[model samples]
Target: MTSSAPSTRIASKLGLSDRIFAGPRSRRLLSTVEAGLERVDAALVRELAMADSLANATSRYLYDAGGKRVRPMLALLTCQLGDGATDKVIDGATALEMTHLGSLYHDDVMDAADKRRGVPAAHEVWGNNIAILTGDLLFSRASQIMARHGEAAIRLQADTFERLVIGQMHETTGAQDDDDPVEFYLRVLADKTGSLISAAARTGLTFSNGPAELEGALTVFGEKVGVAFQLLDDVIDLSADPDETGKVPGTDLRAGVPTMPYLLLAQRSDTSATALRERIDDGVAQIADGADPELLDDALAELRDHESTQATLDLAHRWSAESIDALAPLPDGAVRDALTRFARAVVDRSR
Candidate 1:
């Protein structure tokens, strides 16, 4: 799994331009993620081959838009850390990533997102029906991989998948309601993002027959980091260059999804959020390009300056610290450092 350091292109993109990890150890962890992608591709191949021509094109569009494949990497790293290394464990890692990608395929349709990972989304290129079918196929393949392990792994994966779907539905409900509290948003993020990451780490433990206590600790760590990740993503959406984020800014705002930043801003303002929403609806038709751009920019600036952003960052920082602490009890080595650095890396990611 070990290999050389990342290229300058990767280093710059990952915000590792400085000596954050700063040594050979960081390189090995990065190499492991790259290596995991190779395994993930093999699983993706089976799903893609089973799809119809249009579906195949849509699936391939997503495949070509390479991502970090963090879920699989998490499984692999944790497996090694727990003194559990086997083909089954590797397959488990692959399965987790497949499920994650599958959900993204569906999410694009649900989000009506035109792009993902800087490329056109599958649903945008292909019809919604094909996009959904492709996602179902991926989900099936993930299940097949899980079944190969045993009943226990199969059950875990099944339960996780169920939770994932439920989380998606919960988020949709919140968006439709439009007045959801920040706490509800966190709950949706946990079920949607946290459960999978928690399962990945726990799957590694299952392979190793590691202590129950350790598994529970890692579960907490995963949930917290998952929440932190989404918060940072929201923060980035409000501030990062559209080119860098690979999406339109104020997208969540436009969709009327009450994210933490927006919720925070509304809380600070004298006007009620419901009243503000009504105004936006009424005013949208009349907003001139010149006037609207300036107004939107000012609103975004205020949202960024809201105490909520700092509060959210503080929470992210603390959770990342706790993630490292949970793994601290593991034997100290480059493997441990790699995971810790990964947690730190997520917090500081530029895009």
Candidate 2:
């Protein structure tokens, strides 16, 4: 704590949800959050440290580079519903972040991404085998930390990991001929991205002994927010700025990964879209053969202007709105309003 914790504070009295804008209680709670986040950051570094030199370097790479820390934030935020950021909540938040960082390693390897967080991807620097091992190590460490929190934490971590794997698998295999690509991709978003976020929210409630009734609503809310977040990412990929996004625009197309905008384009039989899709397919092939990602520039530029990009944006907004609706069970107050803002803010990035 920047300021030492009180002997104890009544969780409900903090009134963090409704008074976020102004009030002595709001300022106190904000300080508590700042202190909690700082502790989370430090704990992540300590957890990533290892006795083995190679493992230490690889495992710590992206965690050190930095992230939005959204999952950890949600963990801490929901804890306010109960006892606030207890030591257990902080540890759970740190573990939640590690779970996310671990997935990045596997994602980079699958996408053949060259960089992450403004640095070379682990696979790029250390080769895929080493990178994959490092990711596994992170997951293992997260599990070990969860062990401290008992069975519920362990179970949550396991369930999230299962969904993460399923989502990645579906993304990798792609939609079958009979499957709806848009729906498939949304499901991918749910499992791959949403599941972990949902678990993070659950961690706060489960670990902090928050209201039992809010669990279902929070779970749905987290998943929808996750889907919305990824849908926005689909738009972001086509309009990437290296300095801002840490990856070039068209990285997904170049890597031949399917995206919502591209999927929308594929569904159309329009002469113009069909022509553009063919060209993108050609560029993606070049990338698969080790060609420059910039080769996709022209097509991605076209995609940015295409109606499909707008369609994707609209889809994101819909999901975001739905996430807010899921907060219905939450008492109508600052907490629910704050979460609504959070849902909007999550998908509003780069808009």
lDDT of all predictions: 0.68, 0.82
Worst 10 residues of 1 by lDDT: 1-10
Per-candidate clashes come to 0, 2
Give the 10-residue window scoring lowest on summed lDDT in candidate 2.
Answer: 1-10
Residues 312-342 of candidate 2: C-alpha lDDT, one tens digit per residue: 9999999999998999888755456656777
Measured by lDDT, the strongest candidate is 2
Q: Which candidate should be chosen as best, given TM-score against the real structure?
A: 2
Tell me the deviation in Å of residue 192 in model 2: 0.4
* lDDT score, candidate 1, position 103: 91
Q: Itemize residue pairs with steric clashes in candidate 1.
A: none
Task: Point out where model 1 deviates above 4 Å.
Answer: 1-37, 83-85, 175-180, 208-213, 269-298
